[model samples]
Structure formats: structure tokens, C-alpha cells
Target: MRSLVEAQISRIKRCIGERLLTQELASQEGEGVIIANLLNRWNAFGKPVCVKNA
Candidate 1:
């Protein structure tokens, strides 16, 4: 799931960096909601330990 998480993070950063350009991108992909939820949890309690597999 590392790749999945990384993909989500990349998408999120892209969305943030290019909000106007990617406004519809997230909605169309549907992973936006999942990313938001994950981000919220990460912000609240820091990233999960399991994600540091590198």
C-alpha cells in the first residue's frame, strides 16, 4: 500500500499546487474524498507508523 499512499499524496500535492487547474480532476477521479480523510487524520495525529517502510 505504500505506492497507493504515495500516489494519493502526490495527487493531493498536485491539487493543492494547481487548485484551479485541478479542481475538476479530483472530483472526476473520486479519490479526493479518500485523500481528504487521510490527510485529516494525518494532520490530527501525524502519519501512521506503518507508512514509513522506506
Candidate 2:
């Protein structure tokens, strides 16, 4: 479980970034939320789907 979590964090660091670009505390929190939403959408769209032939 720990390694899985670490892998997710590493992915976030690699995909989005290692540092928060915002200066203010609230903005930094918002930045993290935005990154998480982005990752969720990215994963959602990247999944493979099955199709049925009529």
C-alpha cells in the first residue's frame, strides 16, 4: 500500500510538477486540487473501452 501511494506521488511529480507554482497558501491548495482533477480526467479518458458489434 505504501509503495502504491509513493508511485502515485511520483507520477504526480513527474506529470504535473515537483513544486507548487502558486505563492499564497490558498492558491497552493487550489493548485493541488486542480492537479488532482486533471489527473482524474486524464486517467478517465485514457481507459480502454469495449464495443459490441450489432
Candidate 3:
């Protein structure tokens, strides 16, 4: 569960960062969307989506 959360957080961070770099989204707005998506997925699943560590 921890791993899944971490992975999701990492991906969100990366996406927002890329968007920021491209000037496609303001940092705050990008982050807000990322959090919203993450929470939505978490709530929908009701369980951690585990990812295997590579």
C-alpha cells in the first residue's frame, strides 16, 4: 500500500513538473489536479494499488 501511494505520488509530481516546465499549467493548478485525481482513484478502489518495485 505504501509503495502504491508512493508511486502515485511520484507520477503526479513528475507530470506536474513536466507541465510546469512546458508552461502548460500553473504549478498550483497542476498540483491541485494531480491531488484530485489521486484521491479519486484511491477512494474508488478502496484498496491500495500495489506496484512492484523494480
Give the winner by lDDT: 2
Give the alpha carbon lDDT tens digit for every residue of 1-54 in model 2: 999789878987898889999999999999989988998987787646889999
CA lDDT scores, all candidates in order: 0.65, 0.86, 0.67
- Candidate number that wins on lDDT, 1 or 3: 3
Residue pair clashes in candidate 2 = none
For candidate 1, lDDT tens digit of each residue in 16-52? 6534334577564665566567668767885557655
Error of 2 at 43 (Å): 1.1
**What are the runs in model 2 whose C-alpha is more than 4 Å off?**
1-11, 47-54
Ranking the candidates on lDDT from highest down gives 2, 3, 1
Provide the global lDDT of candidate 2 against the true structure.
0.86
For this target, which candidate reaches the highest TM-score against the unseen true structure?
2
Q: Model 3 misses residue 1 by how many Å?
A: 25
Off by over 4 Å in 3: 1-25, 47-54
lDDT of 2 at 27: 100
**Model 1: ten consecutive residues of lowest lDDT:** 15-24
lDDT of 1 at 16: 62
How many pairs collide in each candidate, listed in order?
0, 0, 0
